[model samples]
Structures are given as structure tokens and as C-alpha cells.
Target chain A: MDHGEKRLMDKNQESLFVRLIPFFERYGILLLILIMIAVLHLLQPDVFLSWRNVTNIFKQVSWQSMLALGVFMVIVTAGIDLSVGSIIMLSLMGLAIASKAGMPWYVVMLVAPAIGFLCGMFNGIGITLLRMPHPFIMTLGTLYIFRGIGNLISGGVPITGFAEQIRVIGNGKIKLDVFFGEGAREYIPTSLILMIVIFFIFWVFLNHTRIGKWIYAIGGNPGAARAAGINVDRILIVVYTLCGFLAGIGGLILAGRTNSAYPNAGLQSELDAIAAVIIGGASFFGGRGTVLGVFAGVMIMGILRNGLNLMNVSVFWQQVLIGSIIILAVYIDVLRRQLATRT
Target chain B: MSDNLVLEAKSVSKFFGTITALQNVDLHLNKGEVLGVVGDNGAGKSTLMKVLSGLYKPSEGSLFFDKEKVTLNSPRDSQNLGLEMVYQDLALAGNLPIGDNIFLGREPTRKVGPFNFLDHKKRKQLTEEHLAKLKINVKSADQKVEELSGGQRQAVAIARATAFNAKIVLMDEPTAALAVKEVGKVLDLILNLKKLGVSVIVISHRMDDIFTVCDRVMALFQGTNFAESELKNTSRDEVIGWIMGKKD
Candidate 1:
């Protein structure tokens, strides 16, 4: 090529690079997830690329992802629900006790969520009506309170042997007989399906409802929302209540899978859920996240853990790496905000 | 009360602990008239506006809207009674789109299978139409408020207040952050609102803005209403004197 022509082509390429910068910034996390999957596949092609292993990852992450969805909503309002982990334990314990007390399986399902709703209402009232200094303190207080109650009710013992119907909700799978080769079947975990359905419903709610719009508005600037005539306290209460309800569902799934309800089943699970939400691109200060991003975030975490296990990585190192990734995600979010404001 | 009076505050007083923010401050707005509220820092201008906008309840006295006694306990109540306020901070959700912010509290929705969903198409169309009528130049209603300039943000806030067809609109330092050229546009907006038979109460430090739009000027001094006069009856220097505590 001529020197002049080469120079013109270089200039065009540079301009194209500049134009694509914003798009890359917006979808950087999704790209990172894809890259992680590729690297894992290269390291352990047989295991990482297996359909069974992929479905297993989804099943394992389903309950935690449900918790993340709840945390996502709470965080969208610029609030945190530390009590969610404890609420899970409490709901599970409630289910176990109800089952042992001759309550029907269907009634136990309804009661579990109701327990969570009441617990969430307690936190909401403390934060909204009592005008607590911060939601962190209020939820932190309830976390211990709920945990203590769980211990008291269960006597620090794990309850096992739930009804078959309850167990099926957690561990049941849909067998697709026609998908694979002859005499081979593919299994989709019912829990995974439940998580996906919940996520889809919430996605529509957040993007297509007035309440969803109000959630964003309240998170963006609560004072402005109040001035705009929104019932800020009521919405805040509802957000926390919903978080509790979802956490309850997660608790029941965990109980079903384990065939037991331990007072400490969900200890520190809030950290994992919060990490997923943050990694998914939800800002700590609120009002900036997407449902799809959250799903990707949960899947990335699941993939990382599954792949690391296949590679025989120590759990200690995995913890360190995951923690570092969380910090890095938040740091990237800060930089993205700075760049946006600068432009 | 005269039939011309759209709103009247009868000796409203507000106290925060030992601090007296406002003391028996009586004020009134006539229908379709623009009233300018001027005061120095800590002179109870915001406090009075807060009371009028229902962000605060007066410790004493009463408020009458359209010559009927009414109590405003919250911002929602004031809005329901056809009063809207544009705060100095603009009070806009920065991360929300222009259309969402404009219709933040009262969003249009469509019912689907017993569930209410936001009507995005209707909201966008109406927002575009309203902005066009207001002569607000913007790329689209979906543009986030954070992406807009200070002047544009101010225009959006004003449009939100006026779009609801409010009987009375209160503005607190609306042009304090705008460029000189943008200030002229805001002044024109206030004039347009007045022509539509909407009563306006503007609190501004800029004498130019007050002179350009207000029919009457009210001076607040040390938490009290010191003086009020028609624009033709008062000079800028005289009003400045009252604001500076040089006259009572």
C-alpha cells in the first residue's frame, strides 16, 4: 500500500476505536464473564464444557441468586439488608417446625414467606418510622435478633425429614429425554427454573412499572423523590419487605436441598449476595443496575467457583481471589462514574 | 379576602428548637400575578417557601387556598391542592431519564392482567409534546437528567412543575446556577406561566430576574415580612436596602 493510503487507514482505525470506547465501558463486566468462561474451558475442557457441570453450576447458584435479586432491590434504594442471611435461617427453621407440627406442605410454603415478610416489616419500621440513623445499623441489629430466635426455636439442633413435596421444590429436575443422544437425558433443576422465573418477573417489574421507576428515583436522590411527592418511607418499607420475602424463598430451597434446617444455614450468605449484586454493576449508592447484569454476575461467580474446584484450587485461595474481584468491581464502577462525569 | 387572591398565609410562624426561622410572616399571591421574595442569607426565605410548599408545618397561623382554609401536612398534599415548588437544588433524580423525572410521582400506566405497567410510549410521546410546547430544546425525553447542562436541568424542573397545570408555582432561586443567557429563557418561562393564569412566587437573589418577571416585590428581614410593594412603586435600590437591613 502507498504511504498516504496507509496513514489514512490508520486514522480511520483510531477514530473507530474512540467511538467504541463507551460501548466497551458499558458491557465490560459481561465481556469479563465471557473471557473467564473461555479461560476455564481452555484449562479443563472436559469438565468445564460438560452440560452436566454447566447445569450443576446453575442449580448450585440458584438459591444464592435469589438472595442477590432481593439485595439488588434493596441496594437500588440505597439501603442494605444485613438481616437477610439470618432471615433465611429463621424461615427454614419456621418451615421445619411447621412441618413437624402436622402442618400441610402447602401451608408450610405460605407460612415460610409470611414469616419473612413479618421480619422484613420489623426492619422496615425500625428504619422508616423510628427514623434510625442508618439502615446498616438497623438491619445489623435484626440479623442477630433473627439468628438468636432461630437458635431458640430449634434448640441449636438441625431439623430433618421434610415432606416429599417440599424436598422436590429444591432438588427436583425436569428430564429432557429428547435433547441428548439416544438413551441419554438432560436434567434441568427445578430450583434453577424458579430462580430464572423470579428474575424475569422482577426484570419486568423494575423496567415496566411505576413502582419500579419510583425505586430508581428514590435511589437516585431520596430528597428529590420526597419533593416529587413519593411516599419515600412506604416504598422503603416495601423494598425491605420484599427482600425478606425473597430471602424466605431462598431459605426454603436451601432447607429442601439439604433435607434439614439448621439455625446457621445461611450464615454470612448476605456477603455472597451483596458481592453478586455489586459485581453485576449495581452501585453502592443506588439507582444504577440491570437485571441481566445481575444474572451475569451470579453466573460469573458460579463459574469461577466451579472452574476453580475442577482445577483443584484451594478454598482459601479461592476466597482471596473472590474478595479481590469484589473490590476490583467496585473500583471499576467508581472509575466509570468519574469518566461519565468528566465527559 | 379578595376574589383575586389565589393563596394567602395568615401570620405563619416556624421554629426549629430555639432558632426562630420565621415569625408571623404573612404573605399572599394574587391570581396570575408574579410575586418576588427577596431576603439575605438566613432571612427565612426558604423557611417560608417550605411552609407554603408543605414541607414544613407552621407553628402558628393558618393558610387559605382560593379563600378556603386548608392545611398542608406533606408535599403530596400541597401538590394535590395544585401547588408545585421548584427548589434551589432543582430536586431532580439525576440518574433518571427526563420523562421519568418529569412524571416521577404521577406516572401514566396501563393495566395488564390486574397489574399496572408504566406506559413507556405514552410517557415518551407526552413528554416530547410538552417539552416542545415549552420550547425546551433537548435530544429526547429518554436522555438522563445528569447528562443535561445546569440550564437544561433547571428547564426540566420548571417544565415538571408547570406541566401539571398547577394553580400556583413557587420557585426558590431557580436561576441561581444558570448561565446569563439561560436566565433570560427562565424569565421568559415565568412570564409564559403568568400569561396562562398561573400564580408564581419566585425567590431570587438576582434583582434583574425579579425586575424582569415579578409584578410585586416582597422583602423579608430577620424572619419577618418587612415590606411589600408593586414593582412600579418600588426601586431596585430601595428593595436592596430592605434586604440589607438598611430599611424596615
Candidate 2:
């Protein structure tokens, strides 16, 4: 088709809603949270809009956002990592065990994520070298294997009593003074600051780098990418390793926040992170996703949980609700893809 | 066809689990010759080119470049030897810009160390200069290769190979999917490459293309060479008949 004809046809093929749907999908969760808060403000402004609820929401999502960023990388390559939760558990166990044995705080923090990196490398080697059918299957196997190992190490009980200095990364915040006013204080977490910095760095890595382009290209059409001479296996390995390392860091924060590390800690956390990524519009088929979209996704999940808590929703029903939301979001994604291909 | 030969494949054979894809296929392309291989589907024209381009290694026989026998283990091996292939699919990442796709694996880097970054401006200028030298009408280096027409994308692929200093190019039906005008553009490109002294082994079933541009024509049938002759001496009907496996 000529340029003019093609442009006309594209416009005719699209409606305002159809064009907006992709944009909405990227930020739909954030928009939903805003709308929900608006509704809550109309109903019970005092309790729902309180500073305590706001801080609680940020605290809850601080670690999950980090997990989402890792998942974002994997999903862009059209791979699934079910082993993040297990990797987190394994990292936490390593950190707690090492710290209990008199390892230095810096040494524990740095060495903990390396354990996760090794797990990712293990998954990468298995998946790429063996040519598994899907990363989902490969990582699912590792998920159970790593969790079992975590169980064997911890003996099926939560590891507790970390060094006081190590816990400060999770529990302590830089105390803000004089900025608000005399005697006014606003605490900002080291973990949350770290998340923002990591997010910014990862955003640049995915968008502004050649390696990031390779990841998307591989996800889009691996055969074509290989023909173009990209080392798909190497890139996949790096992606999984980064995912493992992030999960490790998140697990450290989780351990510090709760003052304990359980074998079942971060159980099903992979599902939450994956859901957030997909909800943010990263596809299972690969080749398209963004950190910004995922940041919005974590925000949506955080707001949903926080809003429910403020509204006195029970924990059991909250799980059901979140599960239903995840299913609905994925179904919508599948439908959108179907509609896209049909056109 | 020349006193100094650039590439020759001697008695190359390939098998796919008892299915002979190519058998004892001997072919030669001297420097600056547009050697055309014409055959019907399943006649091993593509298989021969793939073997030459190192997409597949011959199970039997030897390949020589510049009178030196060599083993090409992979496409990278072929690339290092200044040999490149432009497959029917073009081997481009459509989602990426033309510049990025052209320099897909070997992107220019600047700033070094931890703060290293892609030298986008330098890459763009180099790509534009290269494309311009080829007389390939590209709208912009930043445009996605997919946004270009079939013929323009082909030109981009050819331009990229030339930029990489390829001495031998293997193009498989470069004009098969293009429009009539686009076909003319690709024909012009082949002639242009011939002028630049790049030896090309072009595989196509199109009689007109072979007769128009090829200095020599090689006909294949059922995984083997049926006839090989200079275009000045070979008749179109004779080559077509030989391509159909007619002995007499």
C-alpha cells in the first residue's frame, strides 16, 4: 500500500478506544488505584487517605517492586522464572546462616545475592544448554529443587535472629529533619531508595543499551535474532542470573523486615511478581514490556492490598480477590493479543 | 571465469539423515563474476548457497577461498572470511532501526569502562554514508527496517554486507517477493555489486534475472550440478531443460 493509503487504512482499522487500550494497559493499574482512592475518599476520606495507610502501602510494595523489575526482564525475553521465590528463600537462608556464624554485615549482604546469582546461572545453564521446551518448565523444576534445598538447610523452620546491623537496611530509614519544619520528621527507607535507584538503572539498561535490544529481539523471534548473530543463550543466562540476584536482594529485605526467614517465605511471591508484570502489559510470547509499566503494576497491587486492608477486607478474601484480578488481567491480555493478530 | 578465483566448492555433499540435500555439487565463482544458479524447487540451489555461506557445513568435500582450503564451522566463520549471505528472509531484526540491524552484533561503542554507551551519532553517520555510497534510497537510519518496502530492505542487507567488506555474497531469490519496480531495483543492485568487484552466487528460478545479469549460469537438479556454462554460450532453453533433469 502507498503511504497515504496505509495511513488511512490504519486509522480506519482503529477506534479511539482501540488505540487507547495499549496505553491504558500500561498504566491501567495505576489509574485504577487512583480511581479507587477517589471513590474511597468520597466514602471514608478520613481513614482511607491517612498518612499511616500511605506509608503502609509503600512499605508493603517496596520489595515486590524489586521482584517485578527482575520478572520484567525475563518476560521481555518470553521466559518465565518460577524460581524467584525459591531463590529468595535460598538467599535469605544463606544470609541468615552466614550472619549467625559471625559474617560481617557487608559480607552477608553482598554474598547473599551471589547465592541467588548462582541459582539463576544454574537455571540458565540448564535451560539454554539443555534446550528445554520452556523456561517455565525448567524454572519450575528448579523452584521445587531450590525450595527443597532451602528446607533441608533450615530444617523446615524459619531462621531467626539476624545481626542488628544487617536488619537496619530493611528496618531503618534516613530520618528527614528541618525540611518539613522544626521538629517535623519524615522517614524514608534505605530499601525504598535502593529500589528507586535500581529501577532507574534497569530502565536505562533495558532502553538505552544494545544488550536490551538483543533481549527484545530474541523474545520477538529467536530464530531471526540468531540469524542476525545474537548470542541468545548468553543473553538468556544473564537475564535469569539478574532475576535471581534481584530476588536474593528482595529476600534479604523480606528477612530483615519480618525479623525471620522461613522456608515458605516468599512462597507464591513469584506468582505475584509475574502477575504484576503481565498486568503491566508484558506478554508471555515476549518482545514487549517496560520497567515503567511494571512500576505502575506494583503500584496497582500495592494499592489494591492497601485499600482492602483499610476497608477491613479479610486476609483470606484478599487472596481470592488478588487471584481473581490476576486471572482477569491475563485473560484480558490474551484477548488483546488475539485481537491484535486478527488485524 | 577469471585468472584469479576467489571461491570454489569441490565435491561438496550434505545429508539430512539419509536424505541427500546436496551431493557432489562442485561450483566456482571467480572474482567479480555474477554466478547464477537456477533450478526448480528441491533442486538444492539454496542448499548449495547455505553450505557456501556456512549456514551448514558440508558433510563431504572441501571449500577453498583465495586458493586456500578452509573449513567454515558457522556463519561467523564465513563472515570472518569476508563471505556473507543475504537469505530470502534478509536476516534482519524488523523491530530495530535500519542502522541497528545493519550493525546488529558489532555496534560501535564509546566512553569505555563502566560508563560506556552506544555511539549512536557515529553509527548513524557511518550507516548513512554507506547506504548513500550504495545509492540505496533509505528514508532514515532511524526508521525500522520493517517500515521500508521489500526492495529497500534488500538493499539495506546488501549495503550492510558491502560495508563489512564482503568479497563473496550469496543472495537467495532477493527479488522473489518484490513488486515489478522493486525487482528492477534489486536487478540494479546485483549489477552494482558486480561493478564493485564483489563475487556473487545468486540463486533464483527466474529465467529473466539469470539471463540478464549472470556472467555464468550453473544449473542444478536433484542435489547435483546438471550443467555449467558461460552465459554467452548457454541457451535459456538448454539450461531450463537441464534444470528439469533432461540429459539429451
Candidate 3:
């Protein structure tokens, strides 16, 4: 080939690699999760890879995983909803009180999410309408307010003995027969199914819809999105509302699983959710995240916590490890974005 | 008067709190005519185009498009009316595929029952066709806009406008980031838009671009219309004087 043709061939080969780069980039977090899982299996072969242990982890973490999904949306908009934990508490306690009053299980489920939605709407209005700076302040204020309300209503006590039907969604599992060597049985928790469904919906919303694109665009650059004539205030309201709705769903599941609703039902859940989102590759600067990333992030967190519990690790050590992971994930995000921009 | 008058603004003025950004600016553009809007920084050039393209509503002014007085409430509204604005930034999502970015908000959708899915195949085919029509060559539609050179991005922006059936395109400093050779490609694209019966309003500080592609040049100084003349008739010195707010 002539020099020009040879150079063109080189360029073509380079671009072919460039095309594959996005697939790797998109699945980076998932890859990290798999590697982590593999390493944990190697270290604790029997317990880490056990079917019972895996199902237990999924059941235990699905509620908080839902909250993490909610926080992911808030963070992507370059905002934080510190009140998500409080909202979850409200959802659980409020649903418990309603159920105790002889409300139908269906009505209880519907009412739980409604309370969460209203609470979220409150935050949305407070920030967008009042023109608050940083969702941190707005959500923080709401966080305290929500927690206070939860305590006042429940009198700092737990309510127990929820209806069996309501509890089934949280504590139930479906057993499947796997043809592995023989007809061995495999079990998947219903919460895992819920988690998967929630993940799928958010994934489609974030990647496919016009509203989803607008959310990212707004978070990426509000000024630019405004110049593009996006209804910024409306989108912000919708995002907060959605976050609240998800928190409420999480609250219901938690209450159902424990067969009780308490003021402290979701205590410290906000921190865990935020940790998961940050660890899943969301940027604090805004407008860069994926639903799948958040899913894997939550799984990584759940797996770590499960592994630590099995190993009899101290609570203090777990906290320290999680904190370090959050920092590392955020650092990785910064590095990835920098590399993306430079060339 | 040209039969091809695509966009007409009548006494459009915009204010920001206490400051007047644009004051009763009357501008006209015809199909296949390349109009250069030359202005210094902060001369309300951006403000005027923003109003015309529906990014900003004039505090006081009316606009006419294709002989109809209409209010452009949003960018989508402007796009529906067959008007497109290519900002200096190009308002492009660099991480997205070139075809996806080209058809960002208004992606062609195929319906199966009530559900509408993005017609990716059709979009890729149309993107390639549009790029080819503009005589701009690229490796593939799947390339992220970020991977492309500045000139290629510009080509993508123009192709997007053309694909959306935009008859009047307001470009803000389209060549500002391009290299010298790339600028030539963009200038050629402007002429190509004229050949396709598209009205183009270009905002540029580059005098040569104003001289090369633009048929008529309009100068703005301190939020006022200073002068309007045929590109060939006006001297570069005179245009510079108008831009600098010189009375002579």
C-alpha cells in the first residue's frame, strides 16, 4: 500500500479499538464487582460462594439497594437527598399504623408509596420553588424534619405483627429446580426479583426516555440545558418526586421483611444508599452515572457486608472498609473522566 | 424583497433585570442567502439569536417566520417551525454517538403498536446520507462526537440541522474552534447550505469568513444596528469601524 493508504489502514485499526472501548467503559464497574466476588470466593471458598449465603445477602440488601437507586438519581442531578432514610422510616411507620387500623394489604402498599411521594414532593417544592442552593441543605433539613415526624408518630417505639400477605413480599423466596449434575434445587428471594425489576425500569428510564436524557443534560450543565429550553424546574421536581416514591417502596419492603414498622426502621440508610451510589461510579460533580453501575455498586456493598458478617469482622472495621471503598470509587470516577477528556 | 425570506424579526428587544441586552433589533434573512452578523463581545449578538431561535423570549418584540407572526416559546417550538440554532458550543453531547447527537431530541421513532422505539438503522443510514450530501466524510456514524475532530463535529451539527428540515439556521461562531484547513471545509458547507436553499445566519469575529461566504454583512455595536451592506460593497476597514463603535 502507498503511504497514505497505509496510514488510513492504521487509523481504521485504531478506531476499531475505539469502538470496543465504550463497551469496556460501560461495564467497568460490573467487571470490578466480578473480580471482587472472585477474590472473596478464593479467600473464603465455602461460605462466600454458597447458595444459602448468596440468597441471604440478596434478601438482606434489596431494601437498601432500592434506596441506593433513589439516591443515584438525586446524585446524577448533582444533588443529594439526605432525607431518603427519613422518608423510608415514614413509609414503614405510616404503613404500619394504617395496617393496624385494619386497612387492606393492597391499600397499605398503595398508601406507603403515596406518603413517600408526598414527602419527596415536599422536598422538590422546597428546593425548586424556594430556589434553595444545594439539595444538601434542603434534604438535610427535610431529613431532620422527617426523622422528627417519624419519632413523634411512632413514639420512638417499634410496631410489630404486620399482616402475613404484606410481609411475604419482603421475606418470600421462589425455589427453582436446576439441572446441575442432577435435579438440584436453587432458591432466589422475591426481593431479588423486586431488585432486578426496579433496576431494569430505572435503567430504561436513564438510557431510553426523553425525560431521562433531559435529567442527565440538566445535571451535566443546567445553564446549557436551559439554553436548550428544557423545563429545568419541572425536571427537578420530577426527580425528587421519583426519589421519594422509591424510598417509600423500600420502606414497605423493610417493614414487611421485619414484620414490624418502627421510627428507626431506616436509620442510617441514607448514608448506605449514598455510599452505594458513590461506589457505583457516580460523579459528585453530576450528570454521569448508569443504573447498571448503581446496581453492581449496591451488590458490591451487600457482598462486602455479607462477607464481613460471615468472617465476624467488627462493625467498626466494616465502616472503615466501606468508607475507604467510597473514596476509592469516587477517585476512580475522577480518573476515568480525566482520561476521557484528555484524548 | 426575496421570495425566499425564511426568517424575519421585527423590533425584537430583550432585557436582563435592569440591563438591556438587545434593543429593538430588526433582522431579516432569506432562503439561500448567507447573512453574516458581525459584532464585538457583548454586542447583544448572542441575545438576538437566542430570541430568534426561542432560547430566550424577547422582553419586547415580535418575530415572523415564513410570513407568519409567531411566538417561539421553546427550542422544540423553533425546531418544529423549521428553525435551528448551532451555538458556538454546538450544544452537542460529546459522549454520545454522532448519529445519536445529530438527532438528539427528535430521534426518528418506529412504532410497534403504541410503543415507539428509536429507529437506529434508519438514523445511521440518514446520518451517512446527510454527511455525504454536505461532502463531509467520516469513518462511521457510531463514533462518539468526542472522538471526532472539531471540523467533524461542526459537520455533524450542520448535518443535524439539515436532517431536521431546518430552512433557517443561526450559527454562532461555527468556525471559532476549527483549524485553518477545517475552516475552509466549514465555509464550503455554508455555501453548500445556500445551494440547498437554506437560509444561514452566521455570527463570527473572523472578517475573512464574513467576506468569503456571507452575501450581506450586518454590524452591531453596543446593542444597536450600526450598518448593513452587501459584503462586496463594504470595505473590511468600514466593517471593523462599525464593530468598534467608530462613527466615521
Candidate 4:
């Protein structure tokens, strides 16, 4: 009788552990971030846990997160924007031209995303009207075309001394440190605030809007969406345009932070955005991505980079690790799709 | 040109380059009627359905809706005339929920001054009402299409067509992929569509399905209309023979 009771207790304990495994699976990556932070804190006890370092990471990831979110939408439609990084350069040129022409800071900000919208619109038209087979081809061509255009126009020169408003936008901090008590000297970044606000907007746009659901539908089965009377061409155009628009916003932030518009800005940043989206539990197979998952992905990438830098890791090793993670994430996505279809 | 006729195809022919996919096929469906189209493989049943759905323009002939001479330039033109089609593939987004699939393109919206948002509450309520009317045994309106059985998916497709008040619903091979146990549920959904006063054109190869739910059966053999008659006047053996290219 005593043995039976003991066995029952053991069974109950096993069941509890089994239930916790799902939690681990769901948030195992998050746990990994914490472990990484712990290790980093141990390595750089003074600097890693400092508020300055933490805020710097947030500020750095703010613009890239915008790119990640934008690419997330494009990917949700089973499309890619290889030109996003290149578009950033193009938008930066637009920003420089507008500012140099003595335009208002707000106009300067508008100039970047506006150029992005047009470029994205062109990408959409090329993919749809040109009868291109896939977005991959269309975006690939524009990637080089945009970069070339930026270089031609800017002549490879960098423009600095943006308006005070723009500088604040990129690097200005709101003094919320007083809330932490006297002499805390902590200030929240404007870019970080803007990034979070945009994230909220994107979440609502994807989950609550009609076009958002249509995007998912098109990704899941374009033929079905077309059969259902959706204007598929228009939606694809909208997605590409939105991606371009967001990349422009990133450029705006970039200009503010560096106080300069350089032709080579955001070189290869599109790869980073793609990597972030893939790691965020989104599938390349389309119709399977979440904003929250992508936010986590952005955080993971940002934290990893920050941690590695504090450890004084080589830039090449960082690239190697990020590349490996991208492959691993995609492989996991493929396995997940296989498992989903089997049931 | 009777007032009772909802749709009529007058000697329709479809050619693919040098190959004749359909040759001079004539068909008609009445108000609140279930027409079963039967044929052997490569007999152009799909071609006929596509022509009717306006996915393919008939190479030679005219289409009439409500006895008015009309031309179907595209699927939108047909849909605008209260015509809807549920393809053999069902054309449903498996990742989406039932409500989203039911109202994919024509999602109703609640406009706030300048901004328009999907009226999700209204959508869910209508989806539930339609599913309830069809007596579909899905867990909820929010259930994803991938999670449903083949029968449930078929019911969802029919529900989508009927929800739009489509006067004519064209279905292609509704039961071809369904299991024996699930076939009856699909057939019952078709009956429910009929009971709702909706007209349906069901294309199938199964004689049992035809006799069970369809009021009339038409056969296509080698890209031509071979035979057509009321189900009561025809035997299953005769329809089977008609399917096998045996002439009477």
C-alpha cells in the first residue's frame, strides 16, 4: 500500500515535469536570452549590467527592429525585399538632399519614407505588371539598382549636422531617470519610444485590419485568395510599398543617430532583418508569423550582438554565428511544417 | 428562355490550341435545382464547370443568366450576377479560421470617419449563423480550416457560397476526396443548400452520389454532352453505362 502511494506521487511529479516541457519549448529561446545575459553579466560585471549599456542596446536595435517588422509583413505574404538594405541607402540620400536644400526637419523625415514608398511601389509593379515569376527576382534586381542610384546621386559623400529635432530623434533622451531617484541620469531614447509605438500600430494593423487578414490569405494560397475575389496584385503592391516605407523610417532614425546621411548606410541590413524574422518563429512558407514572436526575435538578435561585443568577440565571428542561426531557424521551420502537415 | 431557368449554356465549345477540350456542350439549370454532371476521366467536366464559372471563355457559344443573353468575361462578372463556384480544390486558406475563409474577399467593415476596420464581431456572428443553418458540426467559427475534416471543409466551402446568397453554386468533385463515412455529411450539406432555396451544379463521377442527392444527372463523354435526364426516370446502371460511353 505504501509502495502504491509512492508510485502515485512519482507519477504526479512526472506529469508536472511533462507539462513544464511545453512551457520550455514555447519560451526556451527566451530562457536562452536570460542565460546569455547572466553569462555576459559575469564576464563584464561592471559594464554589462549598467543602464548605459542597456539603453544603448535598445537604441541600436530600435531602427533595425523597424526593418524586422517591415520585412515580417513582406514575408507574411510569402515575399522578400532584398532591396530593403539598399533602399535605406536610397532614402538616406533623399534625406541628405532634402536637408541640404534647407528643408524643414519634418520634411526631411518625410522625404526618406516617401522615397521608400515609391521604390516599394515600383517593386510591386515590376513583380505584378511585368509578369515576373516571383518577388525574389524583382527584389534582387532592385537591390543593386537602388544602391547604384544612391551612390550615383550622393557621390559617396556623407552629410552631417541634421536639425536639432532630427538629432534628438536619433539620440535625444527623455530624462526618466529621476523616477529611479536622484542622480540616476537615465534617459529613455526617442527612437526606442517610436519603435515601440510603431510596433503597437503594426500589431493592430496585422491583427485587426481587413488587409492584414488578406495578406495572410494571399500568402497561404494566392490562387485561393484570387478565387475568393481578392485583388491580389494590389495587395502585393501594398506589402512591398509598406516594407519600403518602413525601411525609410529606419533611415530617418539612422540619419538622426549618426547626424549624417551616407551613401553606404545600412549596407546588408536586409539580411539582418530577414534573419530576425526567421528567428522570431515565422515560416518562409508564408501565412505563419506573429508580431510578438518577431519582437522576441529582434530582442534575441540585439542582445546576442550586444553581449558578444562586450565579450570583445571578432566581427567575423559574430557574422558567422548569425548566419548559422539563420540556417538553424529555417531548418526548424521546415521541421515544424512537416509536423503540422502530418497531423 | 423560361423564367424558371437560372443559367443556360447554348452549344458551348472550348479549344486548347489544336486540341478540343469541349465540343458543343449544352447545359441548363433551373431555379432551386441540383444538377449532377457526370463523366469519365478526360471528358471535360472540369472544362464545362470552368466555362460556367467564367474562368474560361467558351470558344463557341453564349451564356445566359436569368434568360438574358450574357457573356462571362471573367469570374468577377459571373459573381456579380449572384453566381459562385466551389472548386474541386475548395480554394480555402487552410491557415485561416472558418470565418476568415467564409468572408475572404468580401469582408464587411466598420468605418470610423476615414479609417475602415474589419467588423470582426459581425463577421463571427454571421459565420456562426450560416454554419448553424447548415448544421455544420465544427467546434467554433474560429476553428482553422486545416483542423477540420474533409467533410467539414466541404461544408465550409458550401456555406461560403450560400452565405453570399449566390443563386447558382457550382461544385466540382465535392466528394471525390472524402472518405465513405464523410461522404454522407457532404451530401447532406448539398441537400441543406437546396433546402435553403439555393441552386447547385454538382460535378461527380459517383452514381451513388447522383441518385442520392441530385434531382437530374447529365453525362459528358469525350468532350461532348452524351446524355442527360431526370434521376427518377434513369437507373444507376443506365447512368453508369452513359458514363462508360455506351449509347442508347
Per-residue accuracy of model 3 over A1-343 as CA lDDT, tens digit each: 6999999999999989987778888897888888988988998999898998888888888899889998899888888999999999988888888888899888887877899999999999999999898789999999999888888888889888888778878888676665343455577788889989988988877776667877777676676556556678899999999999999989888877889987677888899998898888777667777888888889999999988887899989999999999888888777877898786
Runs in model 4 deviating more than 4 A are A1-45, A177-184, A331-343, B1-4, B13-24, B59-61
Name the 10 consecutive residues with the lowest summed lDDT in model 2 chain B.
B109-118
DockQ of 2: 0.46
Put down candidate 2 lDDT per residue, B126-230, tens digits, no spaces: 999888777788767888776788899899888777778899999999889888889888888888888888888888888888988899998888998888889
**TM-score ranking from best to worst?**
4, 1, 3, 2
Q: Note the DockQ of each predicted structure.
A: 0.74, 0.46, 0.26, 0.73
Give the alpha carbon lDDT tens digit for every residue of A160-245 in model 2: 88877677767766766757665555667767777788899999788767888788878777776887788899999999999998
Q: In model 2 chain A, which range of ten residues has the least summed lDDT?
A: A178-187
Q: A4-110 in candidate 4: lDDT tens per residue?
A: 99999999999898678657656866776788788889999999889899999988988898789989998999888899999888998889888988999888879
Candidate 2 yields a Cα-based lDDT of 0.83
Model 2 regions more than 4 Å off: A1-44, A47-51, A314-343, B1-4, B10-24, B55-62, B67-69, B135-140, B145-156, B177-185, B232-235
Evaluate candidate 2 and give its CAPRI docking class based on DockQ: acceptable
- lDDT (CA) per prediction: 0.90, 0.83, 0.85, 0.89
- Candidate 3 Cα errors over 4 Å, as ranges: A1-20, A177-186, A337-343, B9-26, B40-51, B54-64, B67-80, B137-139, B146-155, B177-181, B221-225, B245-248
- lDDT of candidate 1 over A150-202, digit per residue (tens): 99998999999999889887888777776765556578888988998999999
lDDT of 4 by residue, B166-240 (tens): 999999989989989999999998898888888899998888789899999999999999999989999999999
